[model samples]
Target: MSRHSQVRESSQLQRRLESLNTARELAEGVLPEQELQSVYDVLERAASRRSLSAEHTVVGFFGATGSGKSSLFNAVSGSELATAAARRPTTSAPLAGIWGEDGSGPLLDWLDVKERHTLPPVPGLADEHTGLVLLDLPDFDSTRVENREIVQRMVGMVDVLVWVLDPQKYADAAVHNDFLRPMASHGAVTLVVLNQVDKLSSADASAVMQSLEGILARDGLGQVRVLSASALTGDGVQTLRGAIRNVVVQREATTQRLAADVTRAATELARASGEGEARGIKGNAKARLASELSTAANVPVVVDAVQRSFKRESAKRTGWPVTRWLLRFRPDPLRRLNLGRDDTRPELSRTSLPPAGAPERARTDAAVRDFADDASTGAPGPWRAAIRGVARDGREQLPDALDQAIAGTDLKATKRPLWWVLFNTLQWLALLLAVGGLGWLGVLAVLGYFQMPVPEVPRTEGWPWPTLMVVGGVVLGIVLAISGRMLGGWAARVRASGAAKRLKAAVAAVAEQRIVEPVEVEITRLKAFNAALKAARSG
Candidate 1:
């Protein structure tokens, strides 16, 4: 593919992966803690540097019980470095064949092994191949399950795999399913050798090679090179040596494997970020959830408890136009700061979003915990903290969302802003001042026209129109300012409240799906992988 095509394919894959990851995260947040934690644990390890050799690659020998893996290792290194026998299950422990007399410094460091059963360098191997560090791993389907794990780990880390299958186990199910077939992605790194092919007649050996080639093709390893070799007779051993030299020495395989691994890790990290940016809800999803929950709780009609309280407090704040200005001064549910201060309290005099019963409240609390887990459980970064951020402004937001939705749906409201109060006050002051000024102007004109001394009008006792006028005019001017300020704050407050609700609702909905679905998906994937492995083993 062209570079552009490759980039586009990558981007497309990234999007699909992100959606899957998002579902997973949301699942964690809404699912039971133990299940969610399991997801987190896997994710954390998946992108991490589990194997020491980020650069050094694994080379493994995998076959049935009697495969001469250890003898081959000894033959390759010119030393009795590994134990090979019919009853022993060949090379119980992984053995390394370092290329240089200089020792496998970076190679071992990359593998992260503190020590190895060391082998002397093959004479021309080190000087010929710079980075080659070959290995003989335990059989993949050995009686020892730990050996299987060892080989499995090696497959993830290793650059090249040299399959050493004897004629009897060459078509073995254990070797195919447990060792070979599942590694479809690593076909380019695989080499198939029929060990002990010399035991058969020449025609039979050719037939076996052809049969193995067909099997490889069927296993999605169409391009894998099939070589016939007899460790007993030294047949085609030099060809195998040349192939290993091409990779282990030149260090070509590690880069390709690393590139693939790194790309997968990057993809997972991007998934942790989710698809593009989350423009949370234009309104709160949680409010939908909360409203649903409140209905479930029988909060509105069943008990008439919270809804009544909400109505009473709402009425009080909205009652008399004269005293309503005091409502402006009381507090904004969405505003953390007062008119000039930042004092915040979540306790509702009327409507509160706190979880109520042990069951319903449990669900609410569970939702918060679940959303938190969801936000966080993705790989390679501070996910829990991100989840926590989602919950930070949650309480204040849900109630506001409920309020706004209730307003838009059930009631019509030109809800006043603080600026509206100021504007009205200013306009009232302007009118009062205009009245007082007019009265004074009347007194001035009367004195000037009659040529008589104007009597000094005493200040009014009860209703101070002059003071009222000044106050009213100022209040009116403040009201005028309200228009300018309303657009942004209204938009912000409405969104903030709406988002709080939407987050609660969407998280709840998304979490609802996560309860058993994630486990189901993983189980299915694992089963498919195992089935392929078993078929390979039977080969």
Candidate 2:
């Protein structure tokens, strides 16, 4: 491959790694730790592998015991660097064979391989295997626990995997189920060799190869190349070498390996997090939540107080002058509750309204739960639980927040109407007229008692003016008082309606801040996580 193509491939791999990291961060508390651990391990391994040699391609030979993987390793290396013995598990530790002297000591050390052999350059072959580092790994199905552990660790770290299987064990359940099946997504960098094929006739060998191909297809690795090779007669070993040379020349095995790892990890995460799109909190759900919160905050009680207080103040202003002062002894309903304040610092004071009872609290809780359920309708269990947990945590602050919202609201109940002032002036004028007429009548009575001539009172409407003035004034003042009372009652209702709206609006604000927003935030997070996972999985 050209330098430009290599750069592009490297950039793509970097983007994939970033996307995987983003997914891991988003899934931190939202997904189960066990489910997310695989992603974490993939990222760690990718980072470590990238930090090592990018110039060299590390090919590992893995197989069960008696698979002759060590013999094949030696056959490919063109030297007996690996001990091919009759022992069931000959390769205890990994053996490294360097082709072109690229200073692979650091890379080998990272792989924990103590045994290393350097192959001398052989004219045309040297160019073919320039930057190849072959590893002879321990048997995956070994009896010893440490040997199995080494194979498992090396499986993830190697750039290319070559599973060497003898015909006898090629279809072994332990090799196919435990190893090959799990690596289904890594077909790009994987190769399977049916080693020791020279032990059978050519027709039998072809039959066994066909059967192995069928099994591999079922394992989701149908695209992986399967080669027939033998260490005894060197049959097909040259083809295997040519395949390795092609991979080394392209210099894309490392990137392909890491990309496959990321893809597999992202697939697992996507499965754990359900594929459903999050439908956010519904409109009716929000409305119901606000309504329940308003009830819990005693908003109706505050609205009623506003109505009664408006009427009380109205009576003091528009009542008959003689009896209006009597209304002052009655307490203002809103004042009694320490509400309807005109000051800017109302929030500093608490209202005397009663605390929410058990039923109100229960309704509020149910509303919050229902909202969470609606928001996380199709989400996975862990994601749904996370949303509910967020809602529950935010509810702890609802009581105080609602109280402050209520106290801070401008109820507009303390404002007096213009009609009250007009009514007050008319009542005062009528009272004065009645008093003046009474005084005039009294003077006439005194004059009669003293035997003096009394002045004739003016008459209108077939009645004396003073008598008419006293009767009409008193009657007009009483009529005005009754009319004002009726008007005030209607105005009180209007004021109460306005106050109810304001109080409910305040409660809605509290509900949104304390409950709805937090739950929606969790939903939005799930959306972002899913998007990142999609990007991680994309080519």
Candidate 3:
């Protein structure tokens, strides 16, 4: 690969790695635990492997028993590194072969390949295969569990995988279904080889290769390169070396392998994350919930108390002063409910409202659930469940908080109307008139008893001045008192209606702060998470 190509590949790989990390973060609570752990494991292994040697290409040879994998490894490196004995599972542990000197110590250590050998640079192939690190991993189908585990670990760490198979076992289900089919995305860094092809005729060899190609194509590996080679006779050894040399020259197998891993992880995450962005709670849904919560909080009861309280206060302020005192004998409705402002009252005073009965409480609970369900409509199962939890949280605080809210509200009950003053003044003037007339009458009676001289008594159309003053004062006072009563009733109703409006508004505010906002917060978080996950998958 050219210098420019290397730079572009590096930049692309960096972007992919970043996306993988973002996907992992977004999928933390959403995806299955093990699936994300697998992604993290890949990233950690890739980082460690790259830190050791970006120049070297680690190619692993994986096959079942009797697949001639060790023979192929020896032929490629031109060294007898792994034991190619005719046994069930000859290779117990992985063997490493390095070309062009400085050993990939850290890389091999990370791969846990203890058997290491340094190969002399191939005569004509020295420059092309300079940084090759060939690994002959243990048989994946080995009877020993430990051997199979070693193969599995090495397979993930290697930059490229060369799956070697004999003519008989090339179509084996274990090799195809277990490994090759699943790793189809790594086609860029994968190669398949049919070993010991020298034993068959040209026609038979062609037929077997064609069959293998068909099987690989069905396994979602249609683009993967398959080659015929005989490790024993060195028939196609040069051709296999040429293929590996091309990969070694590029120095991009590590990044390609890691990129493929990231793609695989992101795909699984996308499946679990579901589709589309989160739609937050709707406005009408919130209003409906608030209405239900108002009912649950006994807002109606408080509003009714406000109206009655307003009426009681209005009567005291606007009625006839003499009899207005009688209105105070009946307890103010709001004061009895332990609501409204009292300067002498303690700050922590709770409203004396009754607890919600079963029917009302059930309606409130159902409304909260229904709101959550509606808000989370079409959301994934996990988000819906989360929304429901958000709605139910802090429910125990509702009753107490509501009572406090009602108590804290200003009912405007202390204000007296100006009309009361005018009526009281009129009554006072009438009383004074009656008192003067009575005193005048007493004076006349006294003068008559002693036979003293008296001034002529004033009269209006034959009615005595004292009698008219006394009777007129009493009759006018009575009419004014009746008018005050009628006016007070009308004013009380108006004030009560206004108070009810204010009280209902206060209740709506409480519902928003306590219930609606929390659910919306979850919706916002879900939206952010979905956006991040989308970028991760696309990148």
The lDDT leader among the candidates is 2
TM-score of each: 0.47, 0.93, 0.85
lDDT of 3 at 15: 72
Q: Roughly what TM-score does model 1 have, to 2 decimal places?
A: 0.47
Encode model 2's per-residue lDDT on 36-126: one tens digit a residue.
8989999999998888888889999998888888888878888877874455337888888887656577888888988787886533234
Per candidate, the number of residue pairs that clash is 63, 0, 0
Sorted on TM-score, best first, the list reads 2, 3, 1
Q: Which stretches of candidate 3 lie over 4 Å from their true place?
A: 84-89, 100-103, 123-129, 199-203, 344-349, 394-397, 415-510
Across 277-358, the per-residue lDDT of candidate 3 in tens digits comes to 5466788887787677777777677667666766666556544455668877788777778766667453477778788789
lDDT of 3 at 18: 71
Superposing all C-alpha atoms, what RMSD in Å does each candidate have to the true structure? Answer: 14.9, 2.5, 3.8
Candidate 3: minimum summed lDDT over ten consecutive residues — where? 313-322
Badly placed stretches (over 4 Å) of model 1 are: 1-58, 83-89, 101-129, 262-348, 351-539
Give each model's whole-structure lDDT.
0.51, 0.87, 0.77
Winner on lDDT between 2 and 3 is: 2
Shift in Å, residue 223, candidate 3: 2.3
lDDT of 1 at 2: 45
What tens-digit string does per-residue lDDT give for candidate 1 at 133-236?
A: 67777777677888778777777666778888877777777667766766655666788888887689999999989888888887777888888877777777
